[model samples]
Target: MIPASSGTGLPVAVNGIEIEVIRRGAGRPLLFLHPGIGIAPEAPVLDYLAEGVEVIAPSHPGFGHSQLPATMTHIDDLAYFYLDFLETFDLREVIVVGVSFGAWIAAEVAVKSTERISRLVLADAVGVKIGDRTSRDIADIFAMTDTQFAEMAYHDPRVGQRDTTALSEAELLTMARNREATARFGWIPYMHDPKLKDRLHRVRVPTLVLWGESDRIVTPKYGRAFCDALPDARFELIELAGHFPHIEQPETFARRVLSFAGEAGVPVTAVKRASA
Candidate 1:
């Protein structure tokens, strides 16, 4: 296992799988699960969150420097893997925050147990089946070209653009690994778990469903449906954003989360600002 680094990340063995995790800060313990695109060492949202809480952001196995166990082939395996993580770390009352594909895994984890989780936040999440068999709730990201995906994924497509030529070989390889891992789990079912919708009721903790106001990948309408399925949940939208609100509106996103978590110094006005 790799030694712990202060702000970057570390390789820690969980269930015999070495997963790279970024951990920092000190108030409340918050477990952040990244989107299918994976988490960068300098993701602004993580910095925002870490400023207020102890943010534990892990690169899902197979998505970064993490070791993917050959036996772990399904998202359910991920759900279970996280449960073990919480237990291993002795973390409790964690504010579990997930975005996009990560939110899907958070939902799965919540369905099984809320014993360790206090509040749940799912931002632009895609995992449940809320429509008929003939309907498509999520965009077919795998089939879209890079340009098409960027257009669909961001309100301002330019925000999603990357100068690949500027990236180091390691950065490029991590991006490729993230794509392969996303397709490995989500491709077969086209992103939704058929049984997940029915099990959402099992999530007893209060949930905050944050969606991008302009997300074409999984429209706000779909996000509302996801919220409605939860017993104790409220829906909020981040303006001028698309599929990844955490990236597009990190300040607002972080403010809303801190408000929801009732973090000690966060002003009550933050809630009003977030809604504004």
Candidate 2:
């Protein structure tokens, strides 16, 4: 494992679309796909992950400053774009870590091709349809009040609290942009791809399904099904956390990830925590 370091932030153009990317640490490449709400450069999960390996966290198009192509309208489009991204950067045997909506994208990319990725970790992922008619595959964050969503999304409510008065104009606008992108890709299918479940077998990479035991958004049962569908996957549960376990419990989450990858022949360090 390499010594600890922060990400080197920059923007790179991929097939005419400019995507914001942060690359840091020095070891094997570990690509981080951000959640639907987007990525804050200082997010602790990235920092912790970087402590152990080279971390590449890129903002999906339309999420941050990344430009969205006119033809890209669905999550699968993002998947294909990322596949191109992998090839463009010539990344091989990369370890992909994703959370919530981001996890969905990772799964999409893996199902399509694992030529670049060796292993994957999906935490509180929102994709695939396995719920019954009465139970929703994923919660409706759009319809919930801020308080309601916060209570459901985090184990500690304070973590989810956002003081609007402290926000800058740019931050507020970015939040709006994040919401818009999420709606375009996730809202219609309610955060899932109807056909994705059946296609999971195509994922040849070993996967780790991490779930927040306290998550009210997507149950562990759903997580189990997700693991089962994959050709090779195992499930791990994080206590004292909700949907975003990596944020709620960075130390435990990072250690779990690092340990999993290490056992699979990838060397990544798991040190003390930060904010994701």
Q: For all the candidates, what are their Cα RMSDs to the real structure?
A: 5.5, 6.7
Put down candidate 2 lDDT per residue, 93-200, tens digits, no spaces.
899999999999999998898888988999999998886777787889998987888898999878898987799999998898989998989987789998888788
Query: lDDT of all predictions, in order shown?
Result: 0.88, 0.85
- Which stretches of candidate 1 lie above 4 Å from their native place? 1-4, 263-276
For each candidate, what TM-score against the reference?
0.93, 0.92
- Residues 27-103 of candidate 1 have per-residue lDDT tens digits of 88899999999988788888898888988999999999999988888899999999999999889989999999999
- Give the worst 10-residue stretch by lDDT in candidate 1: 267-276
C-alpha-based local distance difference test score of model 1 = 0.88
Candidate 2 TM-score over all chains jointly: 0.92
